[model samples]
Target: MTIAVVWLEDDGLWCVSDTRISRRGQGGGVQIVTDAGAKIYPLNVECRLLTVERELYYGRRYGMVFAGMTAVATQTFATLSGMCQALQGASRQDIPSLRDVATLLSKLVELYVRDFRASTTLADPGVIEILLFGMCPVSRSYEIWRVSDQIVEGSLHVAIDQQPARTGDVVAIGSQVSRFQEILAELKQKTENTFRLPKIAVGQMADASRGDVGGAVSIGICNQFGFQTYWSLGLTPHGQGARLMFGVDLDDIGWVGPVVISGGGMA
Candidate 1:
């Protein structure tokens, strides 16, 4: 499980999530499988059409963050991304805005559950939840909508029941929420208005996950351009001196490391 926190401050919508994906080890304990996978997707769509001797372009975006089963999140987003492509050559009425998100996800989640169960005998995946943030095309204001899916049979169910956060509110979703309380409590004692201090609150919550959640915390903010990550870059040497570049989401102000320009590659 990983943490995703969303809060509203002024007119800006802020969201943060850890990138960890974990599975049970051979010893039946939690083992981190990957720490670099992204849970927050900054989707920007620029739909273009070719006409008689001319080209037209339309652009928009919706930023989203997810928590819970990685498989579930991936399946849901693959469909959403496809819709972004269809925005081309369409009227404004066809563009799905922040309000259409919940309905769209409801259809995708139900389809995933029906097809997944039809194929596998594996245990049901817990709730796959997402917080979609962007500008309401009609209202011309920032908004965040919460969507969740859960599969329940005769007996088994696992998930986080997150209340829909209102404007000027904050909510944290994850399996580790209870576990992080003591840590946040201590941190809150030191910092006044932790919710207003998203970087501190989000960082402490991720660290409190121990192995269950640890990764570059992906934080995003809503703007006129839609949802964009508060992003930075990281570089580290490979086997030799050549360094690889990685996009990292910044929880706080990003710090730059050494920079080198190489003929063959980045250093």
Candidate 2:
């Protein structure tokens, strides 16, 4: 089971992980270390892909990411690449908001699920969920939307924190949503006396987990009510294994700072 989390903040955004992934039917000690040696699927468009078959593309005014079980990673990536190609040449300033991105991903997942269900050998394809965070310049507001997954003949579940959503915020997407929330709750409940996970550290820890294919998480933190800092974590499964990729998108006035973090696991 792969798990990921992102955090958006005021000063800057950060992403991290534990670098552990487990193979199917593998027992104890048969673990895959993402840090040791693994192949990573990098986005030529400055985006991140997840093991669960979702994609996150970052733009100047818009940031978008999604997660959930679909077909194999290669097929999902091909579909996403097609979507990106369809999006190319459009003005960055006129990019879709996070909500719009999430909606599109949800729709795409539905289409894929339908196609898979029509196949004879595929059996059951898993579910897909998308969490979108958007910022509107004209309204000076942020919006977060959680799009539930609808697999043709399968089930996919998603859960989030109880707190009200915010624009330029983070989300956890996977079968292990409960675990993600537990981590978030533990972090929030910590007192000032104990060791506190910095926003970046928390973001990273959230990003690192097991079975995270096509999975992703994000965080958004504000700086004294100014611009926002965003961190996003993604998983991409490859032949016999998977890798975790991360990135940060900063919403500063003058300069735009973005970074990509990559690591993989063995078969």
Best by lDDT: 1
| Candidate 1, 15-88: lDDT as tens digits | 77666788768887789877666888865555555445234365677777787767878888888778665555
Clashes of each: 0, 35
Best candidate, TM-score: 1
Weakest ten-residue segment in model 2 by summed lDDT:
36-45
Instruction: Please give the lDDT score at residue 66 for candidate 2.
Output: 42
- Candidate 1 local Cα displacement, residue 219, angstroms: 1.5
RMSD of each: 6.7, 11.3
Task: Looking at model 1, report the run of 10 residues with the lowest lDDT sum.
Answer: 237-246
Stretches > 4 Å off in candidate 1: 45-58, 88-95, 124-127, 152-168, 180-182, 193-196, 232-267
Model 2 C-alpha lDDT per residue in residues 161-228, reported as the tens digit of each score: 12124423445555565766666567657655322243333444534533443223333332223223
The list of candidate 2 runs beyond 4 A from truth reads 11-23, 26-66, 70-78, 81-95, 120-126, 137-140, 151-164, 167-170, 193-267
Residue pairs in collision within model 1: none
